[model samples]
Target chain A: MNTETIQSAIHPNQNHPNRNRPPLCFVRHAVWPPPRWGIALETPPGVGMKNWSNEFIGVDWGTTNLRAYRIGCDGGIQESFEDVLGVSAVSDGNFAGIVRELRETLGNLPMLLSGMIGSSIGWRTTPYVAAPASLEDIAAKITWVEPRWTGLLPGISVLTNSRADVMRGEEVQLLGYQSEHGLTQYTICHPGTHTKWAKVRGGKVEDFRSVMTGEQFSLLKEHSLLKAMMHGRVEPDRSFLEAVETGWSGVELTAELFTVRANVLLSRLPECRAASTVSGLLIGMDLRTGLRLAGHDLIVVLGDPALVRLYTAAIEHIGKDCEPAEGATAFVAGMTRIKEMIQ
Target chain B: MNTETIQSAIHPNQNHPNRNRPPLCFVRHAVWPPPRWGIALETPPGVGMKNWSNEFIGVDWGTTNLRAYRIGCDGGIQESFEDVLGVSAVSDGNFAGIVRELRETLGNLPMLLSGMIGSSIGWRTTPYVAAPASLEDIAAKITWVEPRWTGLLPGISVLTNSRADVMRGEEVQLLGYQSEHGLTQYTICHPGTHTKWAKVRGGKVEDFRSVMTGEQFSLLKEHSLLKAMMHGRVEPDRSFLEAVETGWSGVELTAELFTVRANVLLSRLPECRAASTVSGLLIGMDLRTGLRLAGHDLIVVLGDPALVRLYTAAIEHIGKDCEPAEGATAFVAGMTRIKEMIQ
Candidate 1:
């Protein structure tokens, strides 16, 4: 196989003639097989490439959902599958059986799993690679299951005198972003249940911070008194932008959170706008801390497009630069890199 | 009845010869009918006092619990009753029936209700009296129920150019504290589900702020991922104090909250200490905002003794002087003042 061809295909933008152009924005199309940003896998030109046998299955098994990708020998996604059978859903501890089913359905390819699947509650307990961790550091520490072919990627941890933060699956995406952009210094904001704000320096994760923004938003919207007012979709409306400003203003968050209820009681805010207002507040405060830890002018927001849009709006509102990237694409790129390393 | 006698009985500290002595500290004894702080009621000296027919029952119906006090003609608590029948427990909206049962169990005294009992979900929808409101303003706005003898006190609201805050039952406690201490200027911190921090000036509520600290703590401890590590009672140990300092240091609270779980995972903190650490972080952030809104040197913390102790510790840790007051005592005093006004 031609190593240069695989590298060029995986990071299309790096070798693109128009590399100086502004970064591409990834928008999700309504139909399946949507066009990718800059990745377009071309058939290799030689017999050795056709005979390549390094195909693999990448699985992101989180708490609520599982996503699987089938990577071709040329390091491009051939097909994908999704299911709600995440790590937490395996109540009977039949993770082996679940993976067996996946292997049967998605071809008998070797498996690489990430996320809570490697935690104590999942299939096995994998140790973490402390920061400053690089893609090579993570690739070297992969823990193999009983089956020699199945490997679990180690998560990353940052322990200091003042803070402790950990991320299981996002490290792969960070590495993918680093490989794709070829930038040694920047910040990446991976927004999710535990949103992580990581600073990358010299092509390695120097340190990072995690905020329970999404979790707090869910808890308040579903269980607290604010639930009654938190109806309707969270749009980036005026109420949301105004709340974003309030959240970013460094007000005491716990105190400011009560305004979501008080404003409704006083009829100053419509009930329908409560959800977006709360979303803005959480994301704004998230950026408030994230921007400080970022230590960079430009932020690369990697996540679902819907959430990325909100973060993009908030980041821009806070007078910072940000680019959106799809999480799946980054995940695939990251897995391919690790797969190459293992081979 | 001799009015001076009733006034002297209620304001025991004010009339005490050694009033210059430091304020008495109220500690809960293990036994029932624990010793009172400064109140020592004396029977009125006139025949009119014996026939004073102005006895009333004060009901504080909240979301999770109900507390009722029977006020004698001398404005002291003659008897008290408690039940889990808060307003939220009444699924059928039989508030009148509930009040009828209360009157039947206790005597057929005219009933005066406070707290969520006056909310929209309660028996009646009493309008809010805007601050700067005093006891007289709230008393004049009380909404009577179907029975002329039953009345619901109005809550207080602060709708300013920048913020909106509302309080139901806590208003009574603020008024009660003022009536007891006669402080023309002070700050009151009523710690509970939605802790209220109010500023009183010239014997009226100037403005206030509310923090969802208690509710957030409950939600995180019971529903979030932190619940797994949040075992054991939240004591005021070293872990709790250190967390309070972190919380009060103007750190991003949502980010700092995640440390509760990370610390335990990294072995820097034990699982049992998670609850107290979280408690400290929340209360520390609570004081961070409450102290700024207080605008006074000494803050009067009024609530259950246990919660009050936590807030007092946090307030002192923030380098502020604070005094602890019983919430029930303040409620009873406020109700007595309202009853006297209505009479």
Candidate 2:
């Protein structure tokens, strides 16, 4: 907000526009617009047409997971891929094995890597451009490495809050939104095991936070005692919605939470209603906390729509408004934005 | 309840008590309750009680963690030990190796083990007894073993509304309560990672439900995206209580729940308060859920008063009345009850 604060937000290392880095371990698959400004005049007999090719490819190679996208240049998607194998599998500096495994299906093409794969552990630490950084500043600082075998670029990590973390591919998501939406200021949320909610202004990400909603859900659903209390499937129950409403209002679940299961077990509620009740409690609590502080910020959530719906519905239940960013499109757009900024 | 329903609830196989099974392996420690009562009861040499002679020890070895006590026959505290080890450590039949490590300290002594240590995986799986199985059924069935091996007692497991789970040690806590305090149809709660809220009727634990509060809390605090946002130490912030009071009433948390951290990280709230807010959201939701359902029947939470206070306080926030089972002498009483039943 002030000169000193702004200066601090814009770190010295990332400001050099001329820094020579590979932007990121770029990975994307795209589907373009019907036509593009920079293409040959004739349309192929078998192919469709569009304005400004939007198709692009994206891969969010995080520390624990790998998400790949196939998109049009304008960020329309054609296909997507996911596998349990993550960068964590890349142990003992044998990144070549990982590169071979990841790229085996796709021909050699520019891939954008994000998350921890961009950390010093994954490939190499690409320095992060602090807040107020331009797409150019970020891309220009990419550290390109030609693997004597195959090179995997590590994502960049921002050091603050005394914690170490990398947001390699997410930066691409930020860049893409800036380019497509004409970035001035907006809030973006990318949900997963550890969901990252970020704020960007002037093509720069001002701040961010991470939540472990996905991981918690998985553990509770699979490993915890509460799992048996609910039916196997995620029910679209009314109780579920009520929980979302609670999360939107900022509820915390603790030992006292055991009652959801007890109620279901008691048949005090419909037998099928309990699992949804538990889920609603978790999601509702999340939304409530956010709404209490976030308060109707025009935000774009970049995650699965089902997940987005949970958040959006929770917010709306409490009279707040929200929109969802198509996860795949954001992935491609993010990579494209980085390319535009760098090249 | 109809005759059929009552018959199902009292099914002999379901109600039948467990018998000692030849262990797949042995316990690592020599856990024994002295003839006295397992609690330390030696009077100061200069003080009184040069009169007491017998020694007793009570050990709670459950599915996930283990805690032990050495008490004098008079039921006075002597020594205590604990470890994070639980049945989960052995996914397969590998329980013997693990026990070896934890039990090396206490040379050897007579011990009384309760909870899951009597489970199939703990010391030995005592068979299940049908309902109407009295204290005599339990104490008579207590499997005495070799000096170095732990003698375990089987617990009652309830199958209802399509839910199946076993509670090891809390059964003993309930028994101890009945032994020490004469009661019928009182509620008992043992709070932990998987907290068990039991319904006891006329000196028998009829049914109980396990809540994953502690596990969920640890997961949210340590492994989730929350870990990135936090500094080292964490206080038992009332945010947990607040979240419960404020969280949506009917909803569950299993669905979508990442926004809490996102709101905090974007500095929507101060970092100092994020943990509490998160805690409150989770615990608050939990409290409401617990109160809305079965725990109202919870007359006595049979553990330290602190746990009783924590659980009861949350319920009070929602205008529910609760009593803590602190220092009520349930253990020795439970021992007495079981001993009398055996006699």
Candidate 3:
């Protein structure tokens, strides 16, 4: 049993005994065989050992879908595919079989999976690592399942004033950002159905907060009194800007929400504008709390382009700075960094 | 050209010059035929004028239904009936015909309608009476619709810091409480889909605030993530009390809401208990904001028994006093007072 931790891929000074070994790969974004870090296989799987090359795979298995990336030995993506059978949908308990098929097709690569795959509903429930956790802390806690070919990453949990908060998958992305920019403090925001604002200090997640802004926005737009008033696309309009300012003013969100409907009924505020206004208010409120915690540090937003744009605009509106990163790209980069740590 | 308001059936000191004259009746929740105010009926229209005693009818015509209260000349509810055809349902513009049929069945009675029946979607759009408005102010603004059979009571509108707030049916109920108590200062809380807290001073609603507690609770329980955790009866339990206290602590609601789901997942909070906790949190938050604006005074809660109980429990939880009043009874009393003033 020769097991050793792989040292920092970014910093050669922070040495580990296994640092000189060829690193394991977890790929994303990059095209297949991108010469820089890609090794082309000279033979097919089960071929003669002289020509075969062992690879690594990264899986972002979330509540809605499972995305698998096959990385060449040199850390570049060779191919990628996705299965719609997310953790929530895999009811037949055939997770091993599903992974087996993929592994066979991709030459039996060693795999690391992140996101809801480790949730209670996933293949195995991996206990969360309490915050003030570094990438090494997370990588050490990875649950090596019964299947020797797979490793599952644990989610991060933070206890703020006795209120428990947890996030899966995003923790990996945060580590990726940290690996790319070493041992520095930054506010990493991953916005989606449940948006998280995490503080990274000295390459560890100090603490974070989760706001139900995205979920509430969806519920209100689809099932609330404001639903009928939401006519056009939920883009940031003039009303959206005004609402953002209103939210930033420390107003109670519940109280202010009633006024949205009242304004539509009494002031004849256009329905389309009302929808945008709601989005602005929710996003603005999240930012208000998030930015306060973030302080005057670099704020990096990772999410869909449309959502990221909204947050960026709101951030600048309040005289703050923000950088946008694609969520999928960050997920892959984060997975790659973690793979290097366990290699 | 012969137009006159109905004479007071309750006020003894306030003399109407038309007291001796035959008083035309426009009834609502109020009972009539009191010995002091009752007048002998004149000859009835058409065939034999002998046994036909024209009654006053009080119609609580709201958004969902039409509640007609037929009263004797003296001050008493003779009989009451409800029609499911609400303001929204009367799309054929047969409001007059509807009222006419009811009037004929009850002996050609004059009707006083209140609630959403006077809104833009109602039979006639009655303008709202601005707040800090007395019963007299509201009475003066009542619109006499084209249908000779009905008088629509105007809803009250309040502008708080330039935010427009309006209440149709609840205002009448608040006045009913005021008329019964004779214009003392009190905080009147009417709980429903949209809960209202009004500041009443000397027979007038000075100002008020509307909180959408009930509707939000419904949306969260049925449509949001908490829906799964919201099993069992939603009645107040120990969890409800605890949640109410949590809500009254002035925590940001949006942030706290996420915990309702997280607690069930992490802490194993009972699914049934989660429902009551959510209710308590919502009600408690409303009371916190509502009571602060209501000031230190007698709090009158007027609504359904179940809802009123929740509000009463929450109000008392904070060491405050709350008096529960049935909504229907108050509306009748309020209408009686308004009828007296107009007369």
Candidate 4:
């Protein structure tokens, strides 16, 4: 199928740049890293590929959403699909049924799943590789469910005397960013519901920490008394920056959070500014810890563009240098690197 | 008609000290302050007093609960009634109906309502008296919804260049504690859903701050991803104390909070310890701020016995001096003091 077909199915409203591009056409033995498995020449040409050995489906199955990428032999995304069928939605443990459906849509290529799909609640219980872990270390520990049908990427865990932290799907993005940039030492920040900050050294993830800033922000907006005052869109406005300054100044978070409501009540903060104020306060605190952990390493932030913009702004506001990257792109690159290592 | 009747109406399960005590007998002019209004001396003596002018109903109407105290002329609680009908429960703004019912049970005494009842959503939208507020300041700002039937105590607001904080019913408790102890300078911590820490100097609330520790703990327990691992009772156990120490050490709360889930996933922490661990972390962070604000002054914690126990333990664990006081007693004392000012 063409790019429009895939983009439309995933994001129906957004206009795509490659919207009307011709369907992908493949030639025999197109790129390097020759097919490892037996090649079938009888399958259709462009609609479906014959050599499934050189092609793989990378599924980033997280708690709330699933993103699948069809990687060609050239280490590029030929097509993609997105759905909200995450692990939490598989309440009946029918992960097999979901995988079967994915095969029907993305072709019967060997699938590699990451994220919470590797946890106990996912299709199969996969173990966590301890830090400092590398792309090779993670690929070596892949747990195959149906041998050729599905394989689950192991998550990464860091346990210390002071704290313990773990991540599943974000590891791929982190590794992808590291491999793509060819960086031997740098801090990678993947912001999401659980924002992860990982330190890389000697091409391995030495250690990391997770901050629940995004999730807590959602919780406060949806459930807390602060919900009443948190109206309007959360943009990086003056109020947001001011709140970020306050947060970065080392004020207590829980106490400062109360000021969101207090400011509204005292007529110091308007309702429209409340949401951004809350966002800035949380991000500022998250950055406070993140900067301390990063310590002299350049922070590479990868996530949704809106979140990236806010984080980048906060980082700069604190007079720190931060580079923005695309999380989806990193995931694809990481998956491509791992696919090459498999068998 | 007796203590048991009132105690059972309020707390049906807890044993009361004065249970089954004989009905109260009143002698005229027994207290220092004489009656201010008309003296009927016509109604039933012990069951319902004839003169409501010397007596008043003190109602602490909050967000989630309503507590009514039939305060006698001797500055004592003759009878009390409590229900889950807080301001939030009055969705249709039928606060008058609730007050009418409270009057029917507690007597036709003019009522003085404190807490969220003075908030925007309560019976009347009462203005907040600006700090530093004294009992006299709050008494003078009482908003009369119905001059003869109901009066709403003004909440307190502290506005500065850096931050702003407001409290509804807590001002009563703070002032009550100050007046009861006859202290000129001290710090008071009233811990609850929104824990309020106020500095009482010269018998006035100099300034105050609020931390949403209890509310955030409840939110994390009920709504966040951490909810899955948070099971069993949350006591001040070893896990709780350890988490508290970490929190008190000034770790970034959001980052450290994620350890609740991470520790569970890595098998480092058991499921039973999750609840207490989360509590200790939040409390520890709260105490870190509370202690900083309290400085060298003794912190008097007043609230529910269970919450007081936790705060007391956390405070002492940090090697700081803290005294536990009864919140209901403070509320009653403050109400009595305010009632006496209504000439």
Candidate 5:
């Protein structure tokens, strides 16, 4: 890591015995105004870091949020930084500039990048390699950041005779999960703007589906006709079952949608009851679609703890079993496991 | 009828034999100039009648889209007029003047008022009387337009043991429906800005519901997050069923609504598809709830032809049945039935 990052990370309390000599050991801290921003502001790159070695700092280049972690030789964080730089920057015409900032901040350190950085808009499309091959196989062929920093982590393509799908950072998370749990296979779901439900067998994410259900849900309640019938948040109700029942009945959704707002306005139906109705419709459909492909009982979910909780509840309500797998911790753990195989 | 309205409606087609003016009629019509500027042109009341001895007319006042019928001795219309005097004047805070103009044009003849005219913002808030009554019940309580038109039929109301819902012109439609069908029991759905679904048994509306689906749909799709996701008319696979499906499946419509435009950017779920998805969810749930009350048999839908077509397709997909009933025609039949009863 850079020297300024190093000095900021070195605790002031760690004065040397001589009181004038250089000290050792560094710790990652969430200081106000993270260290990177301060370093870029105070000492521009070349003036300092003439004293560091070549090594990676962890990078999370996601579709909507960005963050980074610096690891020392002993695998400890020297610093960490995060921003809402989101992959959306590329969609808005600023991919090259941010890459320059990343290079300047981290200096010459070889970086291990995860997430959408491997996608087409990132540094360079590094095609994803499959799993069960340790970090080296999954490692991007050659992490290349053009002068402009326009690059991406090549996404892993899961395909068979019948289906095909691609995933980026979550693949790393899966690898981290597999290497950590020591399981031959598992089912995982990462929820966000685009929720990915994947099936891992022989330690490879063999297949998956992306559902826009979450996004659709948000739009419907807050922006669509359905919103008119609601008072936003409501006390939990059993009527949620009606929603699921409606889905299973296979009633076409198009024509009937008007009734949600209508019944409530008509006062023939209670407004509060709409919450469960909306929830049941989305989760129920996704569950039905997923079960059709993944064999319901054999699958497990990996997502936000709360979302996982809700997923579990919905599954149980529909006569299925489910549980949550911590995603972030699993990511670091899975990476650590790959670190083992590499050594 | 007011003198001028009687005169304008009478015209001198005497020897031409088509002067066929009805004793009294209540159809509303208006024609507008080019460019849809909404300028209305109506013949002054009494003068036209001076030329033809036996003629009168029925007028319908709405917030927008006005119409009237020139009738024969048997209540047959020899001509008609329609335009956009609509309730915009009142909605625009010009109530008094619009009412005065309406009075001068229609004269003292009996003219019926509905829509916003009965709203607190309209001509006056004419308290509604329960259904199953006739012109006698309504015309008897005419809210006189002083210094102008005198007798105006009041609106109608649906009352249950615990609640009361009212409609003016639609009440007229219901009266028309009850009298014409020759049956005292049926379910009627009036589809418009505020769609009303009513259950009538033994000549009285026993249960009814109002859904603000249309208004909400317009506001959200045009003004909310959904604005970005939309691409003109989206016809769901099975409009109501699929929409209801989403509603019932627990899509979490409310929570996910705000994310629509963002998700559109991330999921690339196709901007065109987003609108249909929203439509599908809301309308689908409406159909589901409606089905709950419709029971398992064929439901006779009293609504617009287009809406009836949608309802028929949705219900049939769910193994239920639908019979289309023209809302306007039913109103006419109901009026005729009531007239026969009175005669």
Candidate 6:
């Protein structure tokens, strides 16, 4: 098999020839030729799909990319693969075909899918379960795609008071942490394009708020007038901390945003540090409002390590305590618990 | 000038063949062949430039456009001309050549120029007069480009409490209104790409805040995810009013913005009204912050009539009082006062 085929299974985002490939999953016995599917494979010289026999597959299918895992009966992760053919990339509703192809490659093992794959735009339209729901309630609502595979359409949590708010995929991640660790109540901050702060209580996600911090940062960095000064390279921590403090101090954001340009003009700030300041500003605003809604000083920050580190620094800088949770691991753990509940 | 030349003098943005043309201000006795500049003049049959004699020239030379006026000694506007060749369109520091050309054609009676033509990027760099200064102080700061033509380089006002904000071009308009009306204290709202709320004391601009509301709206409408829903057509008044009230009610703007999308998804709001809602939301935020900073309930709304109307509605909706001032008239009045001061 070409290294590309192997790598396609390794780093999905690097290549995806088409978005309409059929679902194909397998524990291969040998390095096989690159399969004719949408996934563009590029396995590094030393890495290839592992030869693992017979295990139930767990999948995290999202909007831009997806990862699949082979899980042993004891819940050990046996093998894994990735592809960039996300729901957004899929064309003409050919998801069933992609799934079939994945089954052909993986030997038709039973499978479980989560994330946006179960949303209105995915393989099947799955209704969102309301908040104050348990893991049992969430798993009970899984949409069965076929006899062998089921899609775990996640629940949506709503906050009626202090303004209307809602969340979808994050509910699964929250349940994952709760089910694996046996915890009841806590606040978790998931940082991404749309960051969410969830308040969990009595083994259920009670309320949540989605802040457009990450999205706003991206817009300002890449598209706004801030883009000019943002390109300068500088260490992000100091500027980020300063901006966080400024934002946390309750300055009006719209008025404060002009300072990004004014500081550069006045030479009080260097150009390279503008982006970090913007990041801190947005994050700080989110945290300020989030903390108000959270009603506590301690928060569980959940996401990838890179994002988690930033939040940890910001939270600690604000004089608050926080615990970090890795998102991928949490996703798998949540999937295993839900699979068990479904069976 | 040919009808095209006459119309070009009449409608500046319609044609400008060259940017380096002079400050030629004249009330032509008859329609001459279209004066060759960048504008390809094709004035429809009916329109032409008026002929008058011995009038002082008033010019508003901004970043993207220029307007030249012939005014009688009594401050009566005799004839006016326009062109798209503002300071930005001037190539290779040709300001002198442009002025020379205008002198050649219009026979250079005393001329007064204002706007960016006096800033660092314009014809000549002029120092900004500090704030809390009187109209005579501002008028005295006019930069004389030649024996016959003087450029008014306005000053920047500083706000020490919340943040630092500065404005150009609008200062002249502010002074114009103050000069004509003899006002001592008031707040003026200048609405445009970057809306300004300036606090005036004893005919001097004391403090001002530059809110990026208009810039932010354009970004959200043209670049943000909100663009898709904003394309629908609807009467803007209702949605604008509703959004303004929502913002004035102390709803956090960042969190409240996402409702523009959510409402469409939930069928709670019609898509056509999205733009109005966005306008109201942004204006409301500005008014809330501006009114607070103004430290008064009464404000003079000065800008183009369309923009002024919106701000007026928003202000009145919040139970505040406002007076509308036409931007062009105020600009001319301010120029007349400055010209008298300089001479």
Q: Alpha-carbon error at A13 in model 5, in Å?
A: 38
Please state the error at residue B285 of candidate 6 in Å: 1.5
Off by over 4 Å in 2: A1-58, A68-82, A91-94, A97-107, A132-134, A147-168, A269-275, B1-61, B64-191, B195-330, B337-343
Candidate ranking under DockQ, highest first, comes to 4, 1, 6, 3, 2, 5
Q: Estimate each model's TM-score.
A: 0.85, 0.55, 0.77, 0.87, 0.57, 0.78
Q: How does chain B of model 2 score on TM-score? A: 0.69
Best by lDDT: 4
Candidate 6 local Cα displacement, residue A12, angstroms: 12
lDDT for each residue of candidate 6 in A1-343, tens digit (9 for 90 to 100): 3434544433233234552454442333233532323323222112122222335667778776767766766666665666666787765567765665555444345677877788666888677677777777777887877643546566574534334555657777777887667777788899877788888887787777777777677677776766778875423489999998987886666767886766765566787888888788888888876788678634889986888888889988998998999876677687777767766
Chain B alone vs. reference chain B, TM-score for every model: 0.84, 0.69, 0.78, 0.85, 0.68, 0.78
Docking class of 3: acceptable
lDDT tens per residue, model 1, A103-153 = 544546678899999998899989999999988888899898844478899
**Which of the predicted structures, 2 or 5, would earn the higher TM-score when compared with the native?**
5
Candidate 5 lDDT tens digits, B1-343: 4333533443322332223433333324332211211223443334332322233334555654454544334544444454444554334455545443443443323243445566554666776666655545764565755422333456666555534455656665665666655666666666554566666666665556555445545656665535655765655354335554555554433333433433454453456667665655655555554566455433566665766665565556556666777765554444333333322
Q: For model 4, name the residue pairs that clash.
A: A115-A169
> Order of candidates by lDDT, top first?
4, 1, 3, 6, 2, 5
B1-343, model 1: which lDDT tens digit per residue? 2223322322233433323433232212122342332223232123332222566778888886677777767767776666555677667677876676555444456778889988888888899999999989988998987344788999999999889989998898897898988888889999999999999987789999999999989999889988888887988888999989988887877788787788888998889889999899989888877888877546899988999988888777767888999988788888888888877
Q: Please, what are the lDDT tens digits per residue for candidate 2 over residues B77-152?
A: 5555554445644444444433332232331334567776665456576765544445666677777654323456
Per-residue alpha-carbon lDDT of candidate 3 for residues A104-143, written as tens digits (9 for 90 to 100)? 4444567888899998778899988989988788889989
- Tell me how candidate 1 scores on lDDT: 0.78
Evaluated at residue A176, the lDDT of candidate 3 is 78
Task: Encode model 3's per-residue lDDT on B188-253: one tens digit a residue.
Answer: 999877788899988888888888787788888888867877876766668888888988876556
lDDT of 5 at B148: 23
Candidate 3 positional error at B65, Å: 6.6
Best by TM-score: 4
User: Predictions ranked by TM-score, top down?
Assistant: 4, 1, 6, 3, 5, 2
- List model 4 lDDT by residue over B225-317, tens digit each: 988878779788899898889888888778888878898888899988999999999999998778888999988999889999998998989
